[model samples]
Target: MPTLETLLLQLNSIKVIDDTIPYSQYIPLDLSISNLDLSQIDIKNPNDFEIYIETYLKKNNAKVAFGGYNEVRNLYKQSSLFGDGQVNERNIHIGMDLWIKAGTPVLAAIDGIVYGFDYNAGKGNYGPTIILKHNLENHFFYTLYGHLSIESIENIEIGSFFKKGQQLATLGDSTVNGGYSPHLHFQIIKNIEDHFSDYPGVCNQKDLKYYLKNCPDPDLLLKIK
Candidate 1:
């Protein structure tokens, strides 16, 4: 039997955001603590971050900014949802993020059935999120699409089917997307366990090992590079 990672690598042409935009138009973005540029702007403010993204995209002459799998970031300080000031603060991002304008269509990475959907309200949360269960090589795994527009889940069915690259949702803005700039938080989960609709997209150093194992680098499936 092929491992989930191996099966993912064998697949081709996967995308989770705005298929109309080619991968060539996507540039890599670094939001980790090492990025000195973040010190110049207020990372807590969505508007400021949006402007930063705009400037970055324009600078690179690209439409999308992608990266952030297993990256340690400081932006979570704005919300207590990530355990602000806690000893084991969850600052490590365990998913890939595609930074784009609000309302950009969010697509399915592969053909799958909707496993769960919910509006994860509150700051530093997923806002509207969806989890899709997929079977490849007789192995079951899941894909999560977070920070989506409310309308995306309003009419979606629990067991609805979506083809690869099919539009599943649209990007949500700061007000409704857990107070962050518009982006699609895409994650791949090998063992979803009891999590439904919502899962931990960030983890503390202590649990980093487990999270990293369960949620492999989305690039294995996306191949955005």
Candidate 2:
């Protein structure tokens, strides 16, 4: 069996934010969500969120601001406005969250077939989600893309094939995405246990060890740093 590091090296790269331009040239020095206009909360509309994210990246001079384990954890802890108080205790955050504005395009990290999808509606939950199954050198694994707009999975079918970097979906707003700030929660799973459209993006402290083994950090493949 291939090790996690080996598998990550084999998979195609997926940037949390756009990487078409040079990081230093496109990134900003002081980027943050608070500085943006919150009145226009519905970033799902065509091109709205994309512009917002681009602006933020330019402001902070950051090529990728979110979608890493440490990045999301810090955002959650600092905001103090998202999630239940049971964040660390609930083993919350089983994935990496891309904190771009809503409606940012989500791409497949590797070539794979659609395994499942669903709308897990609730507070601090993944409103619309999709899971893709990939096989690398005979080793099979799964990737979950959560907090997507309902339109993303409205007609997606099981077993559909997606090439690496293929646009799978777009980010959703807080109301559409479990009532929180906009972001994409991407996770890698070794075993799915018959789940579809939704899986435990967060775990209980008691099962931390089990989940940690089952769902390794997405950064192993993303390599954001």
Candidate 3:
């Protein structure tokens, strides 16, 4: 049997956002703690973060700024959901983020059925989220699409089917998207382990190894440059 990573690599042309925008227009963005440029902006404020993202896109002449898989960031410090400044603070991001404007079409990475959906509702939360269960070559796994508009889940059923590249949801803004700049938090889970509509998109250093193994780099599936 092929490994999940191997199965993902065999696939092609997978996208989680607007199909019209080619990969050429998707530029890499570094939101890690090491990015010195972040020190100049207030990441806690959604408006400031949005402005920063807009400037980044404009300067790079790109439509999307994508990255953040396995990145250690300080952006979560403002939200207690990640934990206080004490032990076990979840500061490392385990999912890929595609920074784009709110209301952008969010598409399914592959054909799958909705496993769960929820309005995570809170600061630093995923907001409206969806999880899809997929079976490829008899290898069952799941994909999580987070930070979506409320309407995206309002009319959807738990077992609804979505085809690859189909529009599954629209991106939500700061007001309803856990108070962060608009973006899609995409993750691949091999063993969902009782997780429902949402999964941990960030982890602490102690659990990094486990998450890193369970959630392979999304780029393997995306192949976005």
Candidate 4:
């Protein structure tokens, strides 16, 4: 299994986001917009909003964007979004999102093998997701990359080897990704429990302690800030 330090070293080398530029340098608009606040821009439909976000990412020359804690909170409350009445207090977010235009490259954070993949189609869902299993030193864990294009899993074989920082997939748009702005939903798992291609990205406040322990802060590896 790998130690946290070893995983950090691998993720640091991956081009998950633009290191030369800060998110503020790329997205001048209030980060709040990425959340659930829809009043700032005129969005008659979901696709319209998705396109707007995708365009913004491209203009900023950002290969990937991060930061949206507040927005994700709002997404949970939206009935039209997750459709789960009243935020699943037990299902608050457990991952940090990396916003980038669809088709933007996604790389493995560590050397791992394909664990599973799935197409969870719906608003506030992880569409075309992939999970990789890694064993470092004596620690075994998993990494999940969600909201990916369908092409990402078209021919991927289970147990396939993936080198650290290898191009795993590309970001998917709202049409394919869950009905929201385009982004990569990355999460770390200590025990997958036979699950594949999908894991809880959110948890209720009551389970916060458990989820936090199971899913360590991804920034520990990504170090985006």
Candidate 5:
């Protein structure tokens, strides 16, 4: 059996985001405090986060701010969903986040059937989420799209089929998207383990090894570089 990394390298044409913006338009943005200067701004607030994203994008002359997988961040500290106040904090993001404007159309990366959809409303939640199931080279896997607008899941049905590049959902604003800046949390799951429209997009240090393996780098499939 080929590893997920192997499969990703084999399948070289997969693209999760729209190709209208050339790959040069995408820039890497580090949310972690170690690299970015966040001394004056509150990283937890969505407005401030948005400002930071916009400022950084403009400074770098890029349209999309990409990269977040395995990044340890402070944005999840405000919510108990990430084990806030706990000894082992779930601050390590296990998926890639595409920092773009709200209402941006999210497209399907491959032909798949909608496994499920859910509205997980709360602070530091996935917000409107969708799960799609696909089979490639006899390997069954799932893709998760998070931080989507409420309308994204409106009238969405399970088992719905979508072709590659099909419009799947739209990015949600901070108010509805877990109080964070608008972005798409894209993840690939090798084994869902009964999870429906939701899965852990972040993990604690204690569970890093497990999640790092289960939710491999989305860039492998996105090929955004």
Candidate 6:
């Protein structure tokens, strides 16, 4: 079987964020152990996190930031929804996050129909979410767009077709986007299975092996680097 990464490598281009944002202006962010910036924010305060994000973009003179597939993040530590009892806290993220200003236009990476959508309201949740079903090459897979505004999913249907680079949704603010900074959490899934509207974008270390395969490195297709 050709792995998700192998299939993604065959694609020439895929853009989840608006194509209008130039590649040169993209600042790749790191929230792992190597980053000094992640330490500046108080995980409990959304405004504090947002301020750091805004400052980082301004300092670098960049419009948007990208990266974070399989990247371990400390942002979810404050939420019990991620860490409770038997579940060993899911901190390892499995998506390519495109961090930019709120209300930024989000685009479809490829031509696909809306598979499902929902308002996952809660702290550390995806907020307004949408999943698109696509048949790329011979593989039937799905793409998830997270942290979108409520309006984004207001008029969407189960089978609404969207063209590549088409304006699909707009990013949401901290009030709706799980109390973090504004950004689009874009992820690719090999098998959506029984999940719809909401899926695990972050996983615990014990479950990393399954998620890493279930959700391949989106950068393989985004090729932002």
Tens digit of per-residue lDDT, candidate 2, span 24-104: 343222222343463354443324645666667767766455643422232232233333546354424567766666777
TM-score of candidate 3 versus the correct structure, residues matched by position: 0.99
Please give, for residues 1-225, the per-residue lDDT of candidate 4 as tens digits.
566556665654344433344444444333443444556554535566666666776877654556543233545543344445554553367877876667778888879999898898876678899999988766888999999999998999899999887889888877888766777888878977867679888776666788788887777776655
lDDT of candidate 3 over 1-225, digit per residue (tens): 879899899999588999899999999999998999999999999999999999999999999999999999999998999998677999999999999999999999999999999999999999999999999999899999999999999999998999999999999999999999999999999999989989999999999999999999999999996
**How many pairs of residues collide in each model?**
0, 10, 0, 13, 0, 0
Off by over 4 Å in 4: 1-13, 17-45, 51-63, 68-72, 79-83
Clashing pairs in 1: none
Candidates by TM-score, descending order = 3, 1, 5, 6, 4, 2
Give all TM-scores, in the order shown: 0.98, 0.74, 0.99, 0.78, 0.96, 0.94
Please, what is the whole-model Cα lDDT of each candidate in the order they appear? Answer: 0.94, 0.69, 0.95, 0.71, 0.87, 0.87
Candidate 3 whole-model C-alpha lDDT, 0 to 1: 0.95
Across 118-194, the per-residue lDDT of candidate 5 in tens digits comes to 98889999999999998988888899999999999998888999998899999999989889899999999999998
Q: Lowest lDDT 10-mer window, candidate 6?
A: 32-41
- Give per-residue CA lDDT, model 1, range 145-197, as digits (tens): 99999999999999999999899999999999999999999999989988888
- After aligning candidate 5 to the native by TM-score, how far in Å is the CA of 94 from where it should be? 0.3
Candidate 1: what lDDT?
0.94
Report the C-alpha displacement of residue 161, candidate 1, in angstroms.
Answer: 0.7
- The CA lDDT at 17 in model 4 is 37
lDDT of 6 at 166: 92
Which regions in candidate 5 have their CA more than 4 angstroms from the true location? Answer: none
Clashes of 6: 0
* Deviation (Å) of 85 in candidate 4: 3.9
Mind giving the per-residue lDDT tens digits that candidate 6 earns over 65-173? 8888888878787787788735598889999998888899998888899999999998999999999988876789999999999899999999999998898999999
Number of clashing residue pairs, candidate 5? 0
Worst 10 residues of 1 by lDDT: 79-88
